[model samples]
Target chain A: MAGELALVADILSIISLIIGIFFLSLGMIGLLRLPDVYNRLHATTKVGTLGAFGVLLSIILQEGATPMGIKALTVALFILLTSPISGHMIARAAYRMGVKCCEGTCMDEYAGKRRK
Target chain B: MKRRLITYMALPVVWCLVSGYVTIGSLFLGLIFGMIVVEPFSKLYRLDEVVHPTGDWLAKIPKKIKYFYVLIKEIIKANIVVAKIVLSPTINIKPGIIAVPIRAKTNIGITGIANTITLTPGTLTVDISDDQSILYVHSIDATNPQGIRDSIRDDLEKYVLEAFE
Candidate 1:
């Protein structure tokens, strides 16, 4: 039974690793194919967070009772907290500099409301 | 008082577990050290209650799963397109920055939207408005900016609304 449990854990670890790889690759693709800066940011943020989660999950599975797993989780939590803030700051900077969207873009909610 | 005690106890326990040196004496020492360190800092920062309609934990799961699914599909599709572009030797990439109007009001909602954007790949969040109502992004490809905006508005903004708005 212990052997079976170990095998299950191994399988879970492998699965998580595969998922992480998939997310990383998808993030790369979004970097490549997305049509605009905002869209690309969207893709990266989602993939980066999920990719980190996948890696952390694999670590937890592989080192269930180890200090390494705890450290991995701590790293994941930090990523979760800071990544968004970084993204927001960057996006905010871009908007203030007057980046333009495509000509036919719909919904200009901020139109005529620029704080001069 | 409750939060302080919780923080004091939780920090040392977490430290001890993560450090992997499990001893009663060390645990006691760590607890004392944690109280010494954490107590003084706790007074410096005050915690504010930020209420959410969907709650924080549950809001992320479904949206994350959906994003994972969509991202995988997009990756496969993008890989083929990029392969073709690379093989063609024309280097037809058109990069540009675009400003997107944001609707989310709260700090959590706005941050969530921005992070969602950065996670995807080719785009980076460049800036947000002072009022937190606009997002600026830099994209490696800017052929269809509107489509990109709509997609974000549909996928991420909806989730942000559910999560924090």
Candidate 2:
């Protein structure tokens, strides 16, 4: 029974890691190909957190709720907590730095408030 | 009073997680340390008191769990959408910022909604007004900003209300 569980865990871990790496690779591609800092930030923040969560989840599944598994969960929690805040801060800073939104961008709500 | 004491319950729980120890000795030590640690900043945890409230916290626990379930679903959906866009042959994203007026009253609720919006794919919360009435959101595609606003109001803000309010 233990061996079977381990086999299931191994399979899950392998699949999760593959999918995680796949998402991370796309985030990297988005970083390179996106036209501006804001777009790249979107790609990296949203995609990267999920990718990291996937890897951490696989670790938890492999370890079966041990202390390390709990710790991994905590790390994942922190990732979710901090990633978006950091992304928001950077995006705000980019806008403050006068980073241009993409040419195709149709609106700017913060534009009027920029001068004041 | 009663609510603050209830808020104290989280301290040892966090201690157990961060210390990564479940033994009786560690738990006793964690209790001692948690008391010392949580005492100084009890006021900061006022948000917890407000969110948890005095009555029916145990019963309402399921709602918070449900919110997280929805959040995780949205997060995964977001990543899949972003992955598709990133891997597309030609990038055709039309990006812009739009103002979204929110109804979340508490600080925690507002922060929760903002973070949820920012974490979701294709949408990022760029700014909140001084009065905290509006969240300026940057979207990777803004052809229909009203749709984005409505989706956030319905999908994210309602859950935040469920969990925190």
Candidate 3:
């Protein structure tokens, strides 16, 4: 039973690692492909966090009783806390500098409302 | 002094349990090392609490769990799509950044939603409005921006509501 459980844990770890890497790669792709800075930021922040979490989760599962699991949990929590705040700061900085979206893009909800 | 002692002692206890080193001697050594090293560093680093979750929202736990289940399923599906794109030789990917209107109000909810978007494959959360009402997303393959926006509005919005609303 112990051996079986270890096997299951190993399989789960492998799966999680693959899933995490996959997300990270996609985020990188979005970063390169997106038309605008804001868009690229979106892809990177969202997908990067998830991918990192997945990889850490797999490590935790594999080392279920080790200090490694605690470390992984700490990293995950830190990423969760920081990534969004960074994204928010980036967007606010861009808007304050008057960065405009693509010409075809519709909806400028922030425009003309506060600008006198 | 007592709080400092407790905080200092926590890591060794965690280390002991994790390492399965239950002997009293080992525990004493680990506790001494942790207090000398880890406790000082922990106090040096500080995080400002910007948003706190109200315990009144505990009633939403069931709904949050259901939403989390759906999100996991979506994440798996997205991973498969991403893998396929990565392996293909054609590399027929069109990337675009699109602005998305966010409905989440509180800072915690907005941040949660943005993080969720970042966690998903093929989408990244780039920016959010100060009012927490808009999100800018970059997509790896954005041949259909409308479809992507709709997915965020519908699927992610549901989970965000459960988690933060």
Candidate 3 reference-contact recovery: 0.17
* Superior candidate under DockQ, 1 versus 3: 1
Alpha carbon deviation, residue A52, candidate 1 (Å): 5.1
Candidate 3 lDDT over B1-165, as tens digits, reads 344555555767765655555568768877887767764565463322233446767888888788677766765665566556645665555665667888888767886787677656577665654556777675666778788889898888877887667
Off by over 4 Å in 1: A11-55, A84-116, B1-35, B47-91
- Sorted by lDDT (best first), the order is 2, 3, 1
Of the candidates numbered 1 and 3, which has the greater lDDT value? 3
Candidate 3 lDDT, tens digit per residue, A91-114? 557756777754344344345333
Candidate that would win on lDDT: 2
Model 1 lDDT tens row, A1-116: 99999999999999998988877677677667655555455555656677777888899899986778877877776776686666566555555677665443443444445566
lDDT of each: 0.65, 0.85, 0.69
Ranking by TM-score: 2, 3, 1
> 2 or 3, which is superior by TM-score?
2
Give the Cα error of residue A25 in candidate 3, in Å: 7.2
Considering the two chains of model 1, state its CAPRI-style docking category. Answer: acceptable
Candidate No. with top DockQ: 2
Model 3 error, position A40 (Å): 6.8
What tens digits encode model 1's per-residue C-alpha lDDT throughout B26-79? 688788888777656665643222323444667467766765566455434443
Query: Model 2 segments beyond 4 Å from truth?
Result: A114-116, B2-8, B35-54
